[model samples]
Target: MSEEDTALKAIEQVVAAVQRTQREKDAEGFLALFHPDALWTTAHGKVLIGFDAIADFTRSVLPGASWDGEVTYDVVHTQFLRPDVAAVKVRQLYTDAEGRPESEGAPLYVMTRGGDGRWLLTACQNTQVRAA
Candidate 1:
């Protein structure tokens, strides 16, 4: 596969892992995708740095939340800034346990290819969509 293809596959896998962890309420598994120094800025404007902090945040927030519908991620774009660095834009949709729409937004993720050539999340920022 081409380098772009490989990167795309890696992104897909990471996204799948994220959804799986959320569904399972596995905070540690979710945070495992992030690098040690990763930074995450949530849609609510909360800034979380480091894997430990992120994991704690997830554990505190995600469990007991009923997620009846799937969390879907639609990749809008992917740009390789360097051979080992990529920027991705994605649209995310979340639904409640009853299948009611919870929220939708666009988010940007910066991923880095580690020494082992596996993609790891470096930073993330959510773009809040204002209602019309």
Candidate 2:
């Protein structure tokens, strides 16, 4: 595969892992995708400035998250800032227990490839779609 294609595939896998971890409610698995210095702003507007903050939040919220829905993540768009960095737009959906759409989100994830060429979530902002 070409360089761009390879990078895209790797990024897609990272997003897939996000979806899977969320679906499984595996907090540690979800946290594993982040960079050590990651920044995460939740849909609720709470800002997590580092891996520790993110980890604490994820552990507290993910495992026993009081949601009657399942969440999914899809890569909607990607912009390469450099060969090692990318801005990824993700479509996030929550499906209720009855399988109906519960809510939606537009999240942006800034991902970067480390020295090991492994893609990690660096900076992320998640916004929920709300009615006007």
Candidate 3:
């Protein structure tokens, strides 16, 4: 595979891992996808800095999140600023208990390939998608 293909594959794997972890409400597993200095903005507009802060917030909310339906995260697009950095757009969907669409989120993830060649989320924002 080409270098770009390899990078995209790695990034996709990271995104997939995050989606699985989140769906399972596995806080530790989700946190592992982030870089130590990661920054995260919640769908509700809360800004969290650093892994510790993200962990604190995630641990407190993820397990207790009041949602009846399933949650899904999918990569919508990707733009590479450099060989080692990519900006990924993700679509987050929530369904009701009956599997009806409840809401959606548009998340932007800035991922960086570490020296170890692992793609890690360095910065991210989860924004709710509301009808205008």
lDDT leader:
2
Q: TM-score for all predictions?
A: 0.87, 0.95, 0.95
lDDT of 2 by residue, 1-44 (tens): 99999999999999999999988899999999999999999999
How big is the positional error of residue 99 in model 1, measured in Å on the Cα after superposition?
5.3
Error of 3 at 116 (Å): 0.8
Reference-based lDDT, each prediction: 0.83, 0.95, 0.92
Regarding TM-score, does 1 or 2 come out ahead?
A: 2
Show model 1 residue runs off by greater than 4 Å. Answer: 96-100
- Clashes (N, CA, C under 3 Å) per candidate: 1, 0, 0
Ten residues in sequence with the least summed lDDT for candidate 2: 63-72
Off by over 4 Å in 2: none
What is candidate 1's CA lDDT for residue 5? Answer: 95
Candidates, ranked, lDDT = 2, 3, 1
Residue lDDT tens for model 1, 36-131: 889899889999998877777888987866756767777788899998888988888887768777778888989899998888889999877776
Residue 58 in model 3: lDDT: 95
